[model samples]
Target: MPEWWTYRLEDFLLFSPRVYWRMFELHNAAVWPLQIPALALGAIILVWIVRPRQWPDLGSDRLVSIILAAAWVWVAWSFLWNRYATINWAATYVAPAFVLQALLLLWIGSLRGRLHFAADRTVRGVVGLALFLYSLVLHPLVAPLVAPLAGRPIQAAEVFGIAPDPTAIATLGLLSIGAGGAIAWLLLAIPLAWCVVSWATLHAMGASESWIPLTAAGLAVLSRLWPRIGSGALR
Candidate 1:
């Protein structure tokens, strides 16, 4: 047998790229028209994000949190627990984390009423908007566009509120816009971690879009940190 160090990342993968992409195809087919309402919900979230609002309002913030929490719960139950676990046993473990995130969002935003999101013209806001649009719109198109080129199924595109990666990405984008304080940092943890996990999985599968998650994570972190860095530089 070859040495452990000699083994490629792909060597450890239990499922091939075809199997991985096909899972999405099956998932999409099974879920059917739910994608329509999911996309509509995403559009509503985008409107909420861009709408003019004073910071820390109770009603809007709580509603947004509830919406996000629902998305997390849906992705956890529908995709990770139900579908992904069949192909990757590790998904069973990951589904709990998604549930935990949903709980956190609920406890912090709905119960305690802490999360506040608003549209700002700052660098972070732009990054947040870009990330949100990418996750909601562009990310779904990725699989369909690449399918023709890569010979993958066209119906395997992942959508926001449905797929874990896009759900996490959209969460990060929403958080970046105006969320602050320790609670914001606490909320950021799981989504950022999931992005890394996603990047690793796709990288192992030799998927060309593996870097997308890592890039999103890095930009989210940097956008969050930039204000601090700017303050320190000025001081």
Candidate 2:
């Protein structure tokens, strides 16, 4: 394993108990599972109602501008909340990272949209797979940092101007779904989104990291081959 991997694994294991407790809250038994269906239905209803009145301007700068504006909104909200709550630096960091993920997706999706590459099967599939992997890994990696700060008092920090609270960090972690499956869903979603876009963009630019997509594809194929060969010996 890479030196970084060994280090991170050690850190993660050290915090396993806290992580498990946080995981419980993330997957708590409540009205949480219904939230998935509710939110999905609401989103579908929203899109149906707001169906594009004009053909989407795939080449418009508006895509970029809107993305920037949305990002600023999150930042501004965090700034004010942090100011009043005296948020800890660590808590503030968590929100910005989550916002960055959304921004990245919009940026990539918009690029593909502008180039009219969104319809291409190969492009979409590659992006989808990369995102799946990224989302999964990113969560567990960052969890340790924020998890340790959860028990801190909700008092403002002079540096960050916001108080650090478990609620905020946990939510930002996508582990606040109040249940376990929700934690799993978020863990799956965020990294995958990041990877798909990053891989697609790098591949398009013909960067050396293009090997990443190939590696992912190879592993996927190998995974499929594994079960079949193992079954044959048993049969």
Candidate 3:
């Protein structure tokens, strides 16, 4: 076998660039208008985290967690397994991880009531909130700006449930909002790993926002350690 250093970017790629971009295009087409609801869900979660008087029940946290879980399931099946795996076979493995994450979120945030939304007003919370917004609004704006660089259209932009960028970013935000513990560790494993994986994938693809995942991952680590100033209003 060839040595790792000697390998070209293409060697790591299972699909041609055309196939990859087409996958994104088809994914966007398949999930039209769904992104609107995804954006709304994210916004609601962020607002809930930021202000508690509007939603006195901790159940809002649980509800948002379930929404996030559903998004994970949708992408796990619709995008990764259905579209992405056909090109990048490794995505088949990744899909199952997403499913497990969905289940984890459902159990902790819904069934167990273990996922309390605190820690969001800390430095970590600020970073996490920024990432969530980046995934929703900022990243999509780049869709038009990077069109020339990527040779694609706005229609091809990767939305939250339809692609990894927003999903990973949104997850980082939601995960940070919770009280970190064993469940936090379990919840973070897949997303943090995906950030690294996606950083490499986006770098290899020469896509815009290539560095976003890695940056978010780093912030998340720091956010966990120094969250001494969390918002007091979380229930």
Candidate 4:
């Protein structure tokens, strides 16, 4: 037997790249039509962040939390537990974390009313909006556009709320908006961890897009920490 150190990441992979992507395709097919309302919910979240006046009460921090909590729960059950676990057994473990994150969002943002968001033209805000939009609109197009080049089906595309990557990315973007207090850090923890996990998994699969989640995670950390470092909060 080869030494442990000689083993590459791909050596530990239980599924092929085709199997990985096909899981998404099958998942999308099984959950047909739900994607439409999921995208609509994402648009509503965007509108609340961009034009708060339109929603007023619904735009409040609590409502955003409830919406995000619902998204997490949906992704946990529909995608991670139901679909992903069929391909990767580890997804069964990951689903609980997603559910825990949903609970945290509810307890902190909804019940305690600790989270907040507002529109701004600052560098952080711009980055946040860009990341959010990328996750919502651009991320779905990524697999569809690239998969065909790789001889994979375009139907493997991952949508915002239905998939874990986009959901985690969008959550980090929204949290970077104006979320404060230590609760913000608590909220950021799971998504950031999932981003790293995603990057590792994709990298193991030899996917060129492995950097997507890692980049999002890096930018999120920098966006949240830069302001503090600039203000001497770190010192």
**Could you arrange the candidates by lDDT from highest to lowest?**
1, 4, 3, 2
In candidate 3, what residue range of length 10 has the lowest lDDT sum?
Answer: 226-235
Model 1 over residues 1-235: C-alpha lDDT tens digits? Answer: 7588898767767888888888888998999888999999888878887883445555666777888899999999999999999988989999999999999999988888777666677767888888999999999988978876777655888899889999999999988875777787899999999999899889998789999999999999998898887731222
Per-prediction count of colliding residue pairs?
Answer: 0, 24, 0, 0
Better of 2 and 3 by lDDT: 3
Candidate 2, lDDT over the whole model: 0.32
Top lDDT: which candidate number?
A: 1
| The 10-residue segment with the lowest total lDDT in model 2 | 154-163
Off by over 4 Å in 4: 1-6, 53-59, 231-235
lDDT of 4 by residue, 11-106 (tens): 768899888888888989999888889899888888878876425444466787888899999999999998888878999999999999999999
lDDT of 2 by residue, 83-169 (tens): 312422333544555465445435433443321211112322233333332322332233343444543111211111111121122
Give stretches of model 2 more than 4 Å off.
1-8, 12-14, 21-34, 37-92, 103-119, 123-235
Q: Give the TM-score of candidate 3.
A: 0.87
Error of 4 at 159 (Å): 0.4
Task: Find the 10 residues in a row with the least total lDDT in model 1.
Answer: 226-235
Clashing residue pairs found in predicted model 4: none
Give per-model TM-scores.
Answer: 0.91, 0.29, 0.87, 0.91
lDDT of each: 0.86, 0.32, 0.77, 0.85
